[model samples]
Target: MFEALYQYQGQLLQGLTTTLIVAFGSFVVGFLIAAVLAPAAVYGNLLTRRIIMGYVGLIRGLPELLVIFLIFYGGTVLLTKLAGRYVEVDALTAGIASLSVVSAAYLTEILRSALLSVAQGQWEAALSLGFRRPRAFLLVVLQQMMVKALPGLTNQWLVILKESALVSVIGLEELMRKSVVAAGATHQPLAFYLAAAGFYVIITGISTLLLKAYETRLTPHMR
Candidate 1:
């Protein structure tokens, strides 16, 4: 095992790098979309809320594989047609886009629920204090909602990290893709897969600890 790992250290490291890039990239973009859409779904006008709802529903109902394929192939086709030329959309770009859209749907639900969990009395108190509606939401409401919703958000992030592995299907050289290539080359499927699993476990374990620390720091002081 040590010899095998030593031999493939470069490939493994490369795989890890790609996986982190895809996961973190998707998370950042997806969280932004969620931040916008979730609030709109909950608090915006009827039309805005309805549109957000429809988007969430459509994304949630579709399979991730199909979403990836559609974004990878369909997006390329659409772009090519619009440009009136052959446009190449790489696997990485397609994977990132698809993952962001899918992740946003889930994050929207998580954040919306978190926002709803904020006590009505808190909003009332902010209003009574002469804070305008927008100001109150920004200052008094969103902070509490973030605290309440962090655990759910963390879970969503973990899901995104795992889902990034599926991007390998489209030939992105992320962890699973690298593992597949190594396994094929060495004819040692179990060894490579087990190593990949260990790497994933290490990443997730570290992430879990960091999130927990952040959650603790964000919690309100108790008497």
Candidate 2:
């Protein structure tokens, strides 16, 4: 067992690197979309909020695999038609785009709740201090929201990380794909599956620990 693992160590590392790259890429893009759209969903006018709400509802209603297929193949077709040429959409791009859209929906809800959780008095106080609406939001409300939603956001990130493995269906060669390939080659499905599980556990463990450390660091300012 040990020798087998050692022999495939480089392959496993490559797969792990691919997994992390896809996860982090999706997270960054998703977080940006969430940061902008989440706040807008909470604070925008009725029409704006309604449109964003529709998007959130649509994304949430669809299956993740369906979304991945739509983005991967559909996007390629659309892009090709638009460009009047063949356009390639790879697994990584599709995974990132699908994950970003799906995660943004959840992030919007998390942030909306976080924004609403802010005491009304905080806003009133900011206004009392002669801060304009924008300034007040930027200076006071946003700060509190970040701290309040950090945990929820971290949880969403973990979900994104796990969901990224689904991109293997499109031939992304991520950890899951690597495990499947190894299992097929070695005829040791249990061993490869267990190894994949261990990898996931390690990734999630490290992510959880890092988030906890961040929360601790922010505790002083939270109060």
Candidate 3:
């Protein structure tokens, strides 16, 4: 069944590279956004908290595919108007931006919960030591929050890994798109499709194992 798949090895690998790039890019960007927004949501004034919560609610309620479409299409139009010429958003850029935005929403909630889990006494103790609020939060509280948030973030990474496939619809040439093309040309849909599924499973499986090990090391008492 995979006989014909052999010829497309290079293409499939290239597609897999794109898939990894999108997933990693989205996760890194999402983590950064969540790092900032999570604290603001937890520590900021009422209006700031409300605004951040509203954004989280809005993005979480929307479909991921819909977000991708809006960014991919809407971004092109907006950029074209701004540049006063034909400006098209790159598919890869759109994939990363949309997924990262969506991922950030969920990550913010995860991190917010983690942040809240931290004891108020920890902050007080840091302040007693003459450390500034930002320093205390960064050096002490944030570290604990990240440790608490690790499992949720790991699962979110897997979610984004799978979600990256949706970018195929926008022509980013990720694994799914490559499989479709290969199956259509080779007339072995099962072979190519199964291969794609297997690829995803392998990547997610490896990721889970690695993250779990890291989690264990981080929280040895829990283990």
Among these predicted structures, which one has the highest lDDT? 3
lDDT for each candidate structure = 0.91, 0.88, 0.95
Per-candidate RMSD, Å: 1.3, 1.6, 1.1
Ranking by lDDT: 3, 1, 2
lDDT of 2 by residue, 55-134 (tens): 98999999989999999999999999999999979888888888888888888888888999999999999999999999
Q: List the residue pairs that clash in candidate 1.
A: none
Tens digit of per-residue lDDT, candidate 1, span 28-95 = 99999999998888889999999998999999999988999999999989999999999978998999
TM-score of each: 0.96, 0.94, 0.96
Give the distance in Å from residue 180's predicted Cα in candidate 2 to where it truly belongs: 0.6
Q: Runs in model 1 with CA error above 4 Å?
A: 220-223
Between the candidate structures 2 and 3, which one is better when assessed by TM-score?
A: 3
Cα error of candidate 2 at position 13, Å: 1.0
Candidate 1 displacement at residue 44 in angstroms: 1.4
Candidate 3 local distance difference test against the native: 0.95
Where does candidate 2 stray beyond 4 Å? Answer: 221-223
